[model samples]
Target: MNRRDTILVADDVEINRAVLRSIFEEDYNVLEAENGEQALFLMRQYRDSIAIVLLDLIMPVRDGYEVMEEWQADPSLRGLPVAVITADDSVESEIRVFDLGASDIIGKPFEPHLVRRRIQNIVSLSQRHLDQDDCIREQARKLRESNAAVIDALSSIIEYRSAETGQHIKRIQLFTRVLLEDVAANCPDLGLDESHIAMIVSASSLHDIGKIAIPDAILNKPGRLIAEEFEVMKTHAVKGCEILSRLDRMGDRDYLK
Candidate 1:
């Protein structure tokens, strides 16, 4: 019921742990562990408060895979969403983690904003699971409401960072909703539904969210950017994609869908 949720960050490296801690500490209550054993112990001690776990694959005593297996074996902890935050990028490792009951995996050397979005999505999902009933309709309704709130909040943050008016987000949401509806009506085979439309509308507001990372001179320039400035502008799309990609792993495929 708390506005801000709690997150557990488990990593062997002090620098990695500090980096993750710094990302979420301001917005969420963060619990840290140096390795898998400490992570498991903390989970057991504060199981109720912990909403999600950001786990590292390599550790001294009991690795992330081992911790995941242990959690899956325990009835009480089986439902907890474990997101692997590892440097491993191999296809086999990804498959293995999913097979081991990990809910998501994030590759390391990550962007701070991307990490924040991912943690927020997983925390939101975990909270929804706890608060909503088992019925699909109820779950869907709760998800829609939660997603709306999240997208709105994120858009507001983006707007705050830009010189553009807040109406930009509002207009984008309306336009995107209409455009998606038209698409769904014309292409039924695309599997676009109310859920998909809502996601599109919500996510469209973020299409230009990465512009916030751009320098004000380029972002707010009245004229076209030069070759170098245009290249910098292009990074906004990549940044936006990265931010949404991390959230995609948290089970909200709507953004990237």
Candidate 2:
């Protein structure tokens, strides 16, 4: 498998295109475009294959600014690296290109070796950023799984003590998720996204966590309790709050706080 990255050289001037093509041809596959329209066409067709773009600011059809604008409008094209090849070295031109998402700008009469190094550096940096993002996402996934396991274990201890079926916990989670989904869909003002809904559903499993503080006699009693016993049972909510507060302080857990 050929692992070489493809570089698109978009310039109206044939000599300029030839120079860049000759420079990078050994290390990369070169695609030439005489105008921005052709450049955009080739970009869309070989979007995954193209690694970076070398675009001329002044072109016959669309020009570099228009090309960058169109690229920015399309979400998928936004991440593709582009470097503007421009004769104008003014501060305004530099700012405009940067705002339009050009990774780098090569001034007119740029050294061949320097251009090669700059393009390579941008590609390397972009790859590093992408790798870091993947690492962060994987870490988040593992953290979520670990949190879920701890919650299930803690909830199960309370269930076992109270002689309640595991289905009781599952049902509460299910109901909470359903209601949250409904609210999210019908009430956009609530600002409940998928993450928020998932969090609330997971938290619903801990509603009976307070039962862990209640005496087994009161917790597992089949008959109605006397007023004094009932009042003691009512304290379970406050007890759960106290227990959670203590755990938060001890562990310094951000979510608990």
Candidate 3:
């Protein structure tokens, strides 16, 4: 029963607001708005904290439709659960309210228990949705961390096998990051978000990984490679692709592709 799990009751009639507040106040923090404008104001102020809105169709300043329209304009508010309340029991009105994205419509002279149960159901479902989203975000974060670790380990193996300086990989990563930033700024059409940029930077270390298959004598030679030696070096591209193909067969993440 967090104070932030607030239930907003927006109605032009004071008695209805009072009755609704009494029903919800024990389990939730109750907010009363006598007009649509006031309701919208409260909703914006408590957007993150308010769990559900008990909205009235008829109100001064702004109606339920107006408030929902404004709220839905902010993409985050598309999921904000709202229940429309009205004294008019017309089927057309109920259909219109649902079309406006309300969770449910409660006709006036409704049973107190029914109203309470409907609101509790909406709140429970909303909380479950939020919980699921949080879990998914956490799992994605862990997966990214695991992928980075494995990529670094493979890069280190390639660097060691090639007799390359430890600092070589570091410099390549830094250069890749700077170039990615420039591309993001100047070439906006590339549509590269942070995650894509990160993957590219990591994969850059694997560019010369095919060198791992070269002989130690050729790789460690002090002078320029002879024609025969250079030809053998060109095979690194095919070797690297073969390595990646094997890894792909192991069911690696799609980002590796």
Q: Say which candidate scores most in lDDT.
A: 2
Error of 3 at 95 (Å): 1.5
Q: Lowest-lDDT window of 10 residues in candidate 2?
A: 248-257
Q: After superposition, how far is residue 50 of candidate 3 from its true place, in Å?
A: 1.3
Better of 1 and 3 by TM-score: 3
lDDT (10s digit) by residue, model 2, range 133-227: 66765665566676777777888897788656478988898989999999988885555778668767877777777878888888888999999
Q: TM-scores across all candidates?
A: 0.51, 0.56, 0.61
Query: Considering lDDT, which of the candidate structures 1 and 2 is the better prediction for this target?
Result: 2
lDDT of candidate 2 at residue 100, scale 0 to 100: 95
**Cα lDDT computed for each candidate against the true fold:** 0.80, 0.83, 0.81
Top TM-score prediction, candidate number: 3
Q: What is the C-alpha lDDT profile of model 3 across 119-218, one tens digit per residue?
A: 8888888888888876765675577676667667778887787655457888998999999999988875555668778877877877777777988888
TM-score, predicted candidate 3 vs. hidden true structure: 0.61
lDDT of candidate 1 at residue 110, scale 0 to 100: 78
For model 2, the superposed segments whose C-alpha errors exceed 4 Å read 1-4, 147-257
RMSD of each: 20.0, 7.1, 6.6
Hey, what RMSD does candidate 1 come out at? 20.0
Number of clashes recorded per candidate: 0, 0, 0
Clashing pairs in 3: none
Model 1, runs deviating above 4 Å: 1-4, 133-257
lDDT by residue for model 1 (220-250), tens: 7889789999999899988877777666634
Q: Model 1 — TM-score against the truth?
A: 0.51
